[model samples]
Target: MSRIARCSCGRLTVRCLGEPSRISLCHCHACQRRTGSAFGIAIFFARARVAVDGVYSTFTREAESGFLVSSHFCGACGSTVWWEPARMPDWIGIAYGAFAGTELPPPDQQVHVKQRLDWIRLDIPEK
Candidate 1:
């Protein structure tokens, strides 16, 4: 079954043509900065299976792992919807926040915990 995610303004929509390969939380400072939150949730899917509609812009940055990652968002509302790693061009990472009705899956893992904010806590049983 396909899943649909859209920007807050509903101007940009992405159709997930297949199930996600992985779902996790990123605690890296760059992710925190990009999300303006303690961490970011990512759902990984094959690039070829994801279809995007409407206009969006991508901002590129180098990850701590030394791979370039591009964050894509709706140009009109500035709502980040997905990302893609330069090293893994065939895969895309959809932000959990983009899903409007679906329940988010539990994060499988947390990356870059070292860069987590001092006040943030990810002490949930599943984390």
Candidate 2:
């Protein structure tokens, strides 16, 4: 299946050409801050299966795993639409919320449980 995920202002977009490689809820501190929520649902796809459009600004940082993670966001709306993790060179992660009017699959797993809030509960497996 194909899907399109765009920034809040619709300036930047990611065209996903097929099923995602994985979907997961991340409870890491960085993800929480980046999403401004309890967790961030990351939809990962093979880099070869996705195409990005429009000009974007990038923020690169070293992740907990010691790999650099580069986030691409629309400059106008400041919405982070997708990111590239150096640890997973062949994959790209799209913000689940960026895909409007689409019902994507539930997360297959969750990570950084140690940083997860105690009030939140989900039926998904832990990674």
Candidate 3:
């Protein structure tokens, strides 16, 4: 079955068919800023495996990987649905928060641990 994720107002939704290639936690400063939180979880799937609906906006920014990342967000609630990172041009990144569940799988790996908040700690190793 496909996993469906939607914006808070239900104006925007994304459908991901099948399992994701990977899921990870990003502790980079940019992620913290984008999520307005300590870290962000990214569930990745091939670009072609996902479908999106409704009008959205894009914001392009350079990631620590030195690639332009274009994020697509809902125009109504400003919730980010997915992002296309230049590093992985063929993949779609679905924010974990977009999912409609609280007991989602834990991130398999963590990235940018050096930039993680000093008080934030996880037993997972940076990959």
- The candidate that achieves the highest lDDT relative to the unseen native structure: 2
Using lDDT, rank the candidates from best to worst.
Answer: 2, 3, 1
lDDT of 2 by residue, 86-105 (tens): 99999999999999899899
lDDT of 2: 0.95
Cα lDDT listed for each candidate: 0.86, 0.95, 0.90
CA lDDT, candidate 1, residue 109: 77
Q: CA lDDT of 64 in candidate 3?
A: 81
In terms of TM-score, how similar is model 2 to the real structure? 0.98
- Best by the TM-score measure: 2
Model 3 lDDT per residue over 1-127, tens place: 6898888888999999888899999999888888999999999999899999999999999888888999999999999989999999889999999996745677899999888888987988689
Clashing pairs in 1: none
**What is candidate 1's lDDT per residue for 34-84, written digit by digit as tens?**
788889889898998999999999899888889999889999999999999
Weakest lDDT window of 10 consecutive positions for candidate 3:
99-108
RMSD of each: 2.2, 0.6, 1.1
